[model samples]
Each structure stands twice: as structure tokens, then as C-alpha cells.
Target chain A: MTAVAVNNIVKTYGKKKEVAALYDISFEVPQGELFGVIGPDGAGKTSLFRILTTLLLADSGSATVDGFDVVKDYKAIRKRVGYMPGKFSLYPDLSVEENLNFFATIFNTSIEENYELIKDIYIQIEPFKKRKAGKLSGGMKQKLALSCALIHRPSVLFLDEPTTGVDAVSRKEFWEMLKGLKQQGITILVSTPYMDEAGLCDRVALVQNGKILSINTPQGVVQEFPYPLWAIRSDKMLALQREAAKLSSVQDIYPFGEYHHVVLKKGSTAAQLEEFIQAHQVDNAEMKTATPDIEDCFIALMKPSIDTATDSLNENASK
Target chain B: MRTLKFLLQKEFRQIFRDPSILRIILVMPVIQLLILPWAADYEMKNIKLAVVDQDHSEYSRQLINKITSSGYFTLTSYSGSWEQSLEQVERDKADLILQIPLHFEQQLVKEDEAALFMAINAINGVKAGLGGAYLQRIIGEYNREVRMKWIQFPRFNPDTQIEVTSSNWFNPLMNYKYFMVPGILVILLTMVGTNLSAINIVREKEIGTIEQINVTPIKKYHFVLGKLIPFWILGLVVLTIGLTISRLFYGIIPAGSFITIYIFAAVYLLAVLGLGLLISTHSANQQQAMLLSFFLMMIFILLGGLYTSIDSMPEWAKWITRFNPVSYFIEVMRMVILKGSTLVDIKMHLLIMCGFAVGLNGWAVWSYRKRS
Candidate 1:
């Protein structure tokens, strides 16, 4: 069963300027699937979550959560879906227990009724249940927010950038909690700017500039990169990057931590790039075939669109 | 119903947990009630009098003595010429100048009437008007005294003299505090009901909690009521404290039944809080809500007949008071607390307030969209 299905959702803001936040976006989340909308800030991830959760109306398109239309059956969808906005939206002055209980009661359910569902996440923050939510540290706040979102045992959960400001450890723990919820057959749609978090999802839609770049399983997205990719390491990494971009065969070049993950043109070999790097007198450069990850795939998919976007912008600016 | 209960629980918990809200709820009424009634006293006193005693006769001295001892005027400048006293008026030192003419005693005895020229600085209109009225009353008293001493055994010429005896009925002592306390209490209730509820929703908007609530299955009326009921209760709580302070400090017991006041107060809070929620629906943040609330409050409190009588206001201002909710509550408070007006007497006001309650709350609920 499809837990969430969005069809050509287009949303724009500002009546005069009409900046489109989402444009012809289409996707679906299957039942019990942990879906991720991976994008950087201002990429319309929050806008998509708000529209699906029925807090916002899309300019043009139809969406359904749990088989209920987002616009037509909003009330029914509201009952079945749990939404955690990008910002921490819980009452900061209420204590942890109060915040959790408050959400439970509004949904006409009690904490004891769904104790098993939120028990793991709740137990972590239960010790500080008396403390005000605003006083909690970043990780504890994220955990409390998740607990509040889950108190009603919603069938479809929408978490928009839940781990945005959280530390590394808490981010991992949060994903683990999402995994556990998915096991209980709750369809979760979570958005994040962190590309690494995409690997943990059952499927991800790489979103940029109000459109989806790709939607596939983690391995499928990486496997779909139809190019010979090379990771070149050298003492003079900056010089190597400048030199590698000059090569006729290099398709894309971006610095990825210790190595620059370089994509070569179709039918190009790694040896051609190596000879070019050596000829440039780049110090101690070593090249090897590198496995593409989601970040590499995201950049490869996003770069060409970005170039065209700038090209159109230049055209408009000249006019 | 259960959603409303949970929302109210959360609202009250938040209100109690934030010390700033508690301070506003507790401290505002106590300070405004205990202090404003005393400070807002409208019985003008300390009128600076510059007396130019040109006559310096026995009658002029007696008249000056009477005016100074009337407890209203302080003899600020006593000089020979009216010009010197005029200088006092120019310097802003004197509010009224009383000039006793030459041969004033002889002219009074021979002609049985005397002309006194008085120059009143008309700046600060209220002070000047009251000061002139006070001086005239004192001189009239002195005239009556002289008439009594000079007349024969028949104390009054009943046929010729027509004396108008006027007495204050409600609030017989004419205590300014008695009148001001009830009006101040109404104002305190208004601030608590309007500003608090206005800021409460916008605070949620600013902090992003309203989005979470918007996505819930909660009904719109339930959400608005959850915001309304607690502050409505808090407004009544503020009224209770204000009434207690008025009774304890100013010795003002309501002439009417407390039940009538509470009944009216309950309905009044609904209209005010509905207006607040309406503002919150338009506002995007706490600052916008606060500014809008303050702007409305300034207009409401000023034209609400708290400082000035509505009947005495100009035609345009009277129309504003007709629409102002604060004016109705202030009038109702004074009517019940001073005149012992029963619910039947204020039935029109009660009916209008009900209209306001229904209209404003209905409009608020209609405008508050759960989705945007």
C-alpha cells in the first residue's frame, strides 16, 4: 500500500515575484518504508513536508497521506499523520513529560496507550522529564520532539530536518530510532541536508531547487552513475584540482575530504587523467577508481542543472 | 472536547511555568489597582492663586482669607498691582488671578454690588476651569455671609431668593476613588484578557508551535477556546484581585450584586479575548501582536469614559465609544458598583455585549484558518 503519494505538487510564494518553492514534484512512499528527502537548506524539503502534512496548500497538485487526500480529506489525514516541522515546534516552556502528554491528549490517546511505541525514545529523555523543553540540549530536544510526534502512534510520520542541528552521536541515534519505528510498520518520511544520512534510508529522493534529482535505493543511485569515476590524492590537492579540471576528459571535479572525486568523460580511462596530473607536475598524485556514494551521485546530478539555471539567470540579467 | 482539554492543560502549564506571564497576571493588577485609583484622582486641588489686593479692605482680606482657607487654592502671589500678578501668570506660576478693585468695600456697601475682575490663565483647560469655578463658589459663600450679617430678623426673602439644592445620589461622598476603582478594575481585566491572549498565540507562531497544532486533528474552535478560556479565567482572576484591593484599601463594596458583575465580566472577557485572537490571526509574531494590542488599547482606554465622560466628548469621539468594548465594560462597572444597577437596568448593555461576544468570536473563528 502507498502510505504517501504526491503528484506534480507545485507551490510558489510571493504574489508579485512568484518564486517557486516546489515545482512539479512527484514521489511516493510505500507502506512501512523509511523514506528520505535529501536536500540542502532552502531546497523545498520543508515545503513538501508541510504540504503533505496538510499544514499548507500546494499551488497545483494533489497529495494523499494514508490514502486520504491532503486538500480534501485534510482532517482525516491530520489524524493519521504525525508531522515534526523543520524547526523545534514543541512548547518550550512545557516540561518534557507535559509536552509528550499534551500531544498524546490532543490526539485523544494516552501515553500508556502508546507506551511501547515511544518507550525507547522516551526512556532516554524521561530522566529529565521535569525540565522545561527549552532547557534541554540539542540531542535531548530532538529526542523529545520525536517522542511527542510519536505519542499518538501515527501510521505515517513526517519529520522535516529533525537532525539538522543535532550533534553527530544524536544524529546516529535518531536514525536508529527511525529504523526501529520502520520495523513496527510505520511509514516515515524524513528530510535532511546530510547526504550520509541518505545511505541509512530504504530509499531517498535527492532534491534540489524545488525539484527531485533522483529517487532510488542508495545502491541504485550510486550504481546509476554511468561514468568512470577517479579519486586522486596528492600533497598539492588544490593544485591537482585546478590541473585536473583543465583535462579534456574530466567531466566533473569536486574535493571530497582527503581526495578529489573526479568523474571522467564517457569512454575515458584513469591512466589518461594520471598522465595529465603528472605532466602538470602536481606532487605525488595517485589515482584510483573510486566507488560513488550518494554525495557524488547528488553532485553529478545537480551540477548540470545548476549550470543551466545560472545560464538562464544570466540570460534574464542581460535582458 | 478532549483536544480542548489537552490544549487548555498545555496552555495553563505553559502560563504557570513562564515567570514573565505569572508576573504580568499577578503584579499588573495589584500595582494598577492599588496605585492608579489614588493617582488618577480627578478632584482638582492645589490651584495656584495670585491675589492682587487693590482694596486691602476688611472685606477684601475676609474674602481672600475665605478663598485661601477653602482648601482648594494656595495663595501663591499676593501683590499690590494686577500687572505683577499677570507676570506670575505669564511665568506659569499662577493658575488664577483674583483682582480686588479700588473702593471695593465702599462700592459694595453703597451700591449693594461690586465688580471684581479676574484673569484666569486658560492654559491647562481643566485646571483653569476648575480653579475659576472654585473661586466663584468661595466668593458666593462670602457674599452670603455678609448678607446674613447685614439683613434684618427675617433670615430669607423667600419670594425673591430661589436656592437650588443639589446632592450627589450614588456615591454621596463624591469619592473619586469609588468611581475610579471600578473603572481601573475594568481596565486591568481588559489588559489581561486582550494583550495576554493576543501575545500568547503569536508567541506560538514565532516559536513554530502553531504549525504542529495546525497539523493536528484539533478543531479550530477548540484551539481558539483553549487560548481563550485560560486567559478568560485569568482576566476574572485579575478582576477578583482588583476588587479585593478596592474593598480592602479604598473601602468600596459594590452597590450591586457580585453575581451581576461576574456575569457581565464573563461575557465581556469573551469579546475582548475574541478581538485578541482576531489580532493574532492577522499578526505573524509577538512584536506585531504587542504593537497592535497597544494601539487598540490606547484608543479603547482613552475613549472608554475612564478619564473623561462619554457624554461630554465630541460627536465623533462618542461614536468611537459606541464601538469600543472597553467603554461598555467601564460603563457597566460604574453602573453596577456605584448606582446599584441591577441586571435588568443594564439589559441593553448586556445584550450589546452578547452581540459583541458572538460577533467577534464568530468572526475570529471564521478567520482563523487551520490550513494556509
Candidate 2:
């Protein structure tokens, strides 16, 4: 069963109605599946989450959550779906326990009734349950928010960048909690800017500029990278990058941590690229064939559109 | 109904937990009630009189003595010439000048009438008007005394003069506190109700908690009612606190029943809180809501006939008072507290208040969107 189904959803903003926040976006979350919408900031991830949660309306097309239409049957969908906005939306003055109990009661259930559902997340923040939610640490606040979102035992959970501001350890713990929620037969549709978290989802829709570039499993997305990719490194990274851009065989080159992940054209090889870099007198330059991760696949799919956008901007600048 | 209960629980908990809200609820009323009435006195006093007595006769002396002894004027300057008294007014030494004309005693005895030219500094119009009226009344009384002494005892009253003895009804003492305390209490209730409820929903919007509630299965009316009820009760509590403070500190007991005041207040708060909630619906954040409330409140309180009588207001301002909720409450408070007006006397006010309550709240609920 499909927990969420969205088709051709488009949203626009601004006074003149010019900026498109979402452009013909379509995807689905299977029942009990851990689905992810992976994209960078302002990539329409939040917009999609808002539309599906019925906090916002789409300009066109339709969506449903747990078999209820988002626009037409919003009330029915609201009762069954749990949405944690990217921003922390719990009352800051209320204590953690009060926040949880408040959400539970509003949903017409008691904390005692939903104790089994939120117990795992609740236990983590239970020690500071008496403390105001605003006074809690970032990780603990997220935990309390998740607990409040789950207190009613919503069948379809929508968490928009829940781990956005969390620390490394807390991010890992949050994913672990999501996995646990999935085991209890809850379908989770989570969005994040971090490419690493994509692997954790059962499937991810790589979104960019209000459009979904690809929707597949982590490995499946990686396999969509269609060029021979190589990671090139040197002491003089900037000089090497400038020199490497001059090569006709290099399709794309962008700095990634200690190395620059470069995609070579179909007829080229890593050895030829290494030789070409050495000829540019870049010191201690090294090259190796690198497998594309979700990040690499994202960049590859995002490049053509970004180039066209930039090209049009340049065209306007020149005019 | 159950959803409303939870929302109310959360709202009350938040209201109590926030120190600023508690300060507004608890400390504001005590301080405003205890201090405002003492400062807001409207009775005019101590009008400076610069007397220029041209007629140095016994009657003129008696007149001067009577004017100074009336307790409304302080004889600031007694000068020889009209120019000197005019200088006193220019120098801000006197509020008004009393110029007694030459041959004043002779004119009164021979001509049976006297012409007194009074030059008044009309700046600070209320002070000038009241002072002029006070001095005129004392002079008129002195004329009556002189007439009584000249006329034969029993034959004086039967035919010549018609005396009008005026009596003040309701508040015979005309105690400004009796008039002021009820008005201030209305203002207190208005400020507390309008400001607190105005910020309640916008505070949620500012902190983004409204988004969470919007996504819930909670009904819009339930959400609006939850915000309204707690503040409505708090507003009544403020009215109660203000009434108690007035009774204890100022010795003011309303002539009418407390039940009447409470019934009006219950409806009055609905209108005011409805206004607040309406502002919250139109605003995007606390600051915007507060500024909007402040702007409207300044207009409401000033034109609400608390400080000034509605009958005395300009035609345009009077028209505004017809629509102003604060004006209606202040009018009701005065009518019930001072005049002991029954519910039937204020039935129109009650009906109009119900109109405000329903119209504002209906607009608020209609504008308050759960899905936007």
C-alpha cells in the first residue's frame, strides 16, 4: 500500500508569482518504507513536505497521505499524519513532558495510551522532561519534537530535515530512532540536505531546483552516474583545479574534501588525466578511479540544469 | 471539545510559565489600579487670579474677598492698573484677570446694575472655562446677598427674582473618583484583554508552534476558543482585581449590582478578545500584532469617552465612539456604577456589545485558517 502519493505538484511564490518552489514533482512512499527526499538548501524539500502534510496547498496536481487526498480530505489526513517541520515548532515555554502531553491530548489520546509508541524516543528526553523545551540541548529538543510527533502513533510520519542542526552523534542517534520507528510499521518520509543520510533511507529522491532529478535506492542512484569518475589530489589543489579545467577530456570537476571528484569523458582514462595534470607542473599530483556516491550522482544530475541557469543569468548580464 | 481542553491546558501552562505574561497579568493591574486614579483627577483647582480693583469701595473689597475665599482661585497678584494684571497673564502668573470698573459702588446703588469687564486668558480652555464659571457664580451669589439686605424681609422672595437651586443627582458629591474609578477599571480590563489575547496567537506564530497546531486534527473554532477562554477569564480576573483595589483603596462601591458589571464584562471581554484574535489572524508575528494592537488601543482609549465625555467629543470622534468597544464598556461602567442603571436601561448597550462580540469573533474565526 502506498502511504503517500504525489503527482505533478507545482508551487510558486513571490508577489508576481514568478519563483517556482516546486516544479512538477512526483514521488511516492510505500507503506512502512523509510523514504528520503535528499537535496540541498532551497531545493523545494520543505515545500514538498508542507504540501504533503497539508500545511500548504500545491498550485497544481494532487497528493494523498494514508489514502486521504491532501487538498480535498485534509482533515482526515491531518488526523493520521505526523509532521515535524524543519524548524522546531514545539512551545518553548512548556516543559518537555508538557509538550508531549499537549500534542497527545490535542490528538484526543493520552500519553499513557500512546506510551508504547513514543516510549523509546521519550525515554531519551525523559530526564529533562521537567525542563523547558527551549532550555534543552539541540539533540534533546529534536528528540522531544519527535516524541511529540509520534505521541499519537501516526501511521505516516513526515520529518523535514529533523537532523539539520543536530550534532554528529545526535544525527546518528536520530537515524537509529527512525529505523526503529520503521520496524514498528510506520512509513517515514524524511528530507535532508546531507547526502550521507541518503544511504540510510530505503529509497531517496534526489531533488534540485524544485525538480526531482532521480528517485532510486542509494546504490541505484550511484549506478546512474554514467561517466568514468576519478578523484585527483595535489598540494597545489587550486592550481591543479585551474589546470584540470583546461583539459577537454575532463567533463566535470568539483572539490570534494581532500580530493576533487572529476568526471572524465567516455574516451578518456584516469592515467591520461594524471599525465595531463603532471604536465601542468602541479606538484605531487595523484589520481585514482573513484566510485560515485549519492553526492556524486546528485552533482552529476544537477550540473546540466545549474549550467543552463547560470548561462541564462550570464546571458542576461551580457544583455 | 476534548481537543479544545488540551489546547486550553497548553495555553494556560504557557501563560503561567512565561514571566512576561505573568507580569502583565498580575503586576500590571495592581500598579495601574493603585496609582492611575490618583493621577487622573479631572477636578479643576487653584486658578491663579490677578485682581485689578479700580473701584476702591467697600463692595469691591467684599467682592475681592469673596472671590479669593472661594477656594478655587489663588490671588496671585493684586495690581493697580489693568496693564499690570494683563502683564501677569502674559508672564503666566495668572490664569484670568478680574477688572473691577471705576465708580463700581455708585453704579450698583444708583443704576441698580454694575458692568464688570473681565479679561480671561483662555489658554488651557478647561481651566479657563471652569475658573471663569466659578468666579461668575461667586459674584452672582454676592449680588443675591446685596439684594436680600436691601429688600424688606418677607416681601423679598414672593415675586421679583426666580432662584434656581440646582441639585446634583446620583453622585451628589460629584466625587471624581466615583466617576474616574469605574472608567479606569474599564480601561484596565480593555488593556489586559486586548493586549494579552492579541499576542497569544501571534506568539505561537513567532515561535512557529502554530504550524504544529495547524497540522493537527484540531478544529479552528476549538483553537480560537482555547485562546479566547483563558484570556477572557483572565480579563475578568483583572476587572475583579481592579474593582477590589478601587473598593479597598478608594472606598468606591458600585451603586449597581456586581452581577450586572460581570455580565457586561463577560460580553465586553468577548468583543475585546475577539478584536485581539482578529489582529492575531491578520498579523504574522508578535511584534506586528503588538504594534497593531497598540495603534488601535491608542485610538480606542483616547476616544473611548473615559477621559472625555462622548457628548463633548467632535462629531467625527463621536461617530468613532459609536463603533469603539472601549467606549461602550466605559459608558456602561459609568451608567451602572454611578447611575445604578438596570439591565433594561443598558439593554441597547448590551445588544450592541453582543453585536461586537459576534461580529468580531465571527470575522476572526472565519479569517483564522487551519490549513494556510
Highest lDDT scorer: 1
True-structure lDDT of candidate 2: 0.88
lDDT of 2 by residue, A3-70 (tens): 99998999999888799999998778889999999999999999999999998999999998999999
Backbone clash count, each prediction separately: 0, 0
**Largest DockQ belongs to which candidate?**
1
- Which candidate should be chosen as best, given TM-score against the real structure? 1
Candidate 1 per-residue lDDT over residues B1-372, each given as its tens digit = 778878888888888878998999999989988888878979788999999989989999999999988899999999989889999999999999999999999999999999898889998988888888988988988998998898775665655866798899998988999889999888888888889988989988999998989888988888898999999999889888988999999999999999999999999999999999999999998889999999999999999999999999999999989999989989999999999999999999999999999999999899998888
Q: How many Å off is the CA of A309 in candidate 2?
A: 14
lDDT per residue for candidate 1 within A1-319, as digits (tens), equals 9999999999999976388899899888899999999998899999999999988899899998999999999989989888888889898888899888888888899999999999999999999999999999999999998888998889999999999888899999999999999999999999999999999999999888998877888987787776788888888888788978888888889999889999887677777787876775547778778999999878877776346433443343223
List clashing residue pairs in candidate 2.
Answer: none
Candidate 1 local Cα displacement, residue B220, angstroms:
2.1
- Provide the lDDT at A160 for model 2: 95
Stretches > 4 Å off in candidate 2? A280-282, A304-319, B51-64, B77-93, B99-117, B142-159, B314-316
